[model samples]
Structure formats: structure tokens, C-alpha cells
Target: MGRMGRIIISVIVILGLLALGLKGCSTTLRKAVFAKAMPGSYFAEYSRIHPSLYQVSGQVYAFEKEFARSMILRTPDGIAVFDTFDTAHMISLKQTLEQEWPQESVRWIVLSHNHLDHIRGSDVYPKAEVIGHKDINQLVADWPNVNSDIASVTREISDDQTLTFGDVTVEALYMPFSHSSTIYGFHIPSDNVVFAPDMMFVDAVPPFGFPDFYYPGYIRALDRLIAVNAEHYIPSHMDRGTRADLIAFRDMTVEFQGVVEDEYLKIDPEDFIQGIGMGDAIKSAYDRLHPKYGHLHGFDAMFVPKFGRHFGGTYLGY
Candidate 1:
């Protein structure tokens, strides 16, 4: 071979190898692996907040004042609220709903769970028929200093419980563990929607928490909800949504479940060694997912200790 030609060929081969190595390290590859790890099948549709609703300080973590107060289900009889803002913020949300749907009253108030964010504002809507998981009442009852306004009409809900109010039919599906003992989602069949609180944090990964409870159950509940085929899955906190979001959530749940199961299934010696690194897998997943969903922590905030305890991780390692 000619000297210059051989040199040129060598340069081409080197460049080709470099290109192939870079391809494996590309952000696109990372994203693809992340997607496989999460297995999301749908995209959440994002839009500007509806004019009728606006944010209040207590509605979200103090940092996010832009989060809307509640999801208003407007019907001819009245507006059915998915959840009310914290007690301090409910008066304004009630007033705003009244101003927009002047002829209607707040007919129903569905509590997705017993979380402060879900039930704090129960007092403001005096006439609404309150519905929630059966266990939520116990959460309120256990609180020695429970707000006086929430004491009434705090009905216990069960799985398959159907609530018919005017044109709306709300079906409460019990979603226990993970976040709370009595976590639940309200399905609005007429609208083909489900009001899911905390189950799908959308863009945020949850921090650790107490009860040191069942996360696999959370995945099961999500799977059950998907089996119901609701087109719109709205969260009690964010208060807006679509069916595709739930589908994506389903895919993500499946992926996470697979990771956990796969990690747990390793043979004894490998299991002990790899178990130590599972935390890294969890963190890597979170780090990759965080950029897209970091805003999640911006809302349903949790301390690292609670998260660590909840996930059984020493810290954020897994």
C-alpha cells in the first residue's frame, strides 16, 4: 500500500471506532435505556392552567405557588371538587368556583386519600357530600387536633363504592400502601377519568416516608386502575390530566416492578454482592428521570429520611 494511503486508512479506522464508542455513550442511548427501565407507553398532555382556577400558597409546597387549588368537575347541579386546597386556601377556591359556575353548588368532594394535601380544605365546602377510602376517616380520627370543619360528612369509602351525584358517577378504588394506608383514586366514568392522588406523581420522584410500607402494592393498584380503562387520570394535587398519562404510568410501573423483581431474583452469592449496588440502580434511574420530573418534588415534597425508610435504602444510594 502507498504510505499516504495507509495513513489515511488508519485515520478512517480510528475515527470509525471513536464514532462507535460515542454512539454507545450518547444521551440518546441513556434515554433509550431509561425508557426501557421505566417502560412508559403514553405522554401526558400539558397545557396552560385553566382561567377559572388559580394557585394559592398552601396548595403546593411553599415554593410552588402556581399549582392550582382543585380540580373542579362542573355539572348542572354543582361543581364536584376532586380535592380542596388547604383550609386556609379553600375559601378563595370556593369563591372562584362559585363565580365561574354561579348557578351550581359544590355537590361532591372526593378525597383521593388522607394526605394533608388531599383533605385539608374539607371544611370550606359545607354542603358537599364527602367521599374517600374507608381508612381515611381513621387518619382524621387519629389526629388529636383534627380540624373542626372536617369532622362532618367525612364518609368512609371502600373499593367498588359507587357515588352517583347528578350527572357524575364517582367510583372509589382502594389503593392502599406505598404512600398511605387508605390511599384511593376516584373514577368519574361519565368523563372517563380517574382522580388519582400520589399514585402517579407525574414528573416527580417521591421522597422517603414513614409506615415503612408496601411499594409493590402501589404498583398493583396502578395496574388495577389501568385495567379499568379510564381515559383521563387526574391527580388530586395537580388537578388536571388525561388517559394517556395513566397509560404511561402503567408502563412505568411495569418497568419499575421488573427492575425490583429482577434485582431480587439473583442467586445467593450474586444477590448479596448485587444487593449492595441496587441502591445505585435506583439512584441512576432517579438521576436520569429527575431532569424530566424533578418538578415533582417541587409539589408533594418528602424528606430524604422518609424516602430512605420508605424505599428501604440507606440514603439516596439505591
Candidate 2:
């Protein structure tokens, strides 16, 4: 072989290597673009503003609007609503309902929990029978300033109440200490879907600002929901999920708790919040978990500060 032959071979090898590198870079860019397109990212805010209706299965429909979601089940008798959005959006929701199901009246309004966002619009459905956990009456009674007419007609449901409307059977199970002490989950046997509010946010980490979390009970509730083996799961705030997503969420929660607890143990219990500092502790825990969960939406900008304060406060008994 001559020197010219060797030079040509070297050039070919370099070009081949460059092609492979470009291909790898392109693949990575595509992945990053897809991740941003998914829920919980910046794109979510735009997608959430416009109310969208999705048919889960048969007569069951999921209505999502700007970080809040609700479900509707239609039967020959009437329509049953899982949760009404905030009171301000009640008019739009009502209009959508009327346009979608003109003849059917909303006969039942079921509250997933006592949270104002999920229940404040109950009065919009005047003729509907409002159903909720017995604790909701007290929650409403405590808030006399809020003009909620649903409280007056709200019927208390037992822990294991099953509501049957035609072919649909919705089982409302009491899941205490998960999101709130009074929170409950709705299981639809026909659709094989479970609607659990505020317990899990699909495709995204839980929000940072709201800190009402009972770690132990939240794990137990997730375990129970997973055991149900539903084909589809609907959370209050985000997109629909699957059993795998629930498992992922549970695993993430357990892993995060372990990391935070381990870090918290490093500092003196008396000085955990003050001396070590809440922000520093949170950043430390986040740094350890970032290798695994850094890709999750809100891990950096939203979750770190809120999780730090909440976990630090819990550790310090504040």
C-alpha cells in the first residue's frame, strides 16, 4: 500500500467517527425535546389553561383545567361529577357540561376531599346530591366565611360506600392521612380506573408550596391503590397515569424520604433547621437525589425550597 492509500483510509475513518458523533448528539437533543413536551414542564402551563375533556372509557369523561382535574360519569339516569373545579371556573364547566350532555342533569356531585379547589364549585350544580366524607361537614362548618351552598345539602358517606348508577359502580374508599385526613379515592369497576386526588401528581413531582404531606400514610395509601390493580389512574392535578407510574411515584417517594432522613440525621436535632439551615439541608438532600430525579419536572426550581422547609420543619418539630 502507498502513502496516498493510507491517507485516504485515515480520512474515511475520521468521517465515519464524525457521523456517529452527530447521530448521538441528535438523539440526545430529541430526548430533551420530548421531556419538555411532557406534563409538569413549562409546556404544561399552556396546555392546562384550555379546558380539555377526555373520554376515559365508555361514559366516563375526565375534564382538566389549569392544574385542576375532574371526572364525570354519565348514566341513563343522570350525570355524576367527581369534583367541581374552583368556584371561579364553575360557569365554564357548567357550560361545557351543558354542551356535552344537554339533556342529562348533574344528579350527583362527589367530593374527592374537602379541599376548596376540588369542592368550592359544588353550588353550581343546584339539583345534584352532594356526597362527601363525614369529615367534610366539619371542614365546611369551620369555614363560615366561604359561601358554599354544597355544605347545607352535603350527605355524609361511610368509609366504604359503593355508589351504583346503572352499569357504573364507583367505590369511595377512605384513605386517611395521605393528602389530608379526610381524603378518599374513587374506584370505577367498569372503567377499571381509580381517581385519587392530591395523593399523586402524574408525570411530575408534587408541588413545593403545599406542604400537607404525611409521608408514612402516603406510602401506605399508594400501596393500597397499587394493590387494586387498576388499568388506569387519574389524579386531580395532572395527566392520567398507569400502575407503572404509581409504582414509580411510590419508589421515588420512598427514595426521597430515605435521602432526606439520612441527611437530617447528620445534623443535631436541636439545630437541624437553625444551624444547618433549611435551605442548605434541602439543597444537600436534593443534590444527593438529583442524579436519579433531576429530570423530573420542578425538582430544581419548585420542589427544593418547599421540600426543604417542610422536611426541616418536620424534623425540628416546628
- Candidate number with greatest TM-score: 2
Candidate-wise lDDT, in order: 0.54, 0.72
- Candidate closest to the true structure, highest lDDT: 2
- Please provide, for model 2 over 81-178, each residue's C-alpha lDDT reduced to its tens digit, 9 standing for 90 to 100: 88886765566777888897798788888888877767887888777788888887787778878746453436887677888865688888888766
RMSD in angstroms, all models? Answer: 13.0, 12.5
Residue 77 CA error for candidate 1 (Å)?
3.0
What tens digits encode model 1's per-residue C-alpha lDDT throughout 204-302? 333334343465676677777777776555554333445566666556445544544444344254655556655554455455444443344321133
Which run of 10 residues does model 1 get worst, by summed lDDT? 56-65
lDDT for position 221 in model 2 = 87
TM-score of 2: 0.78
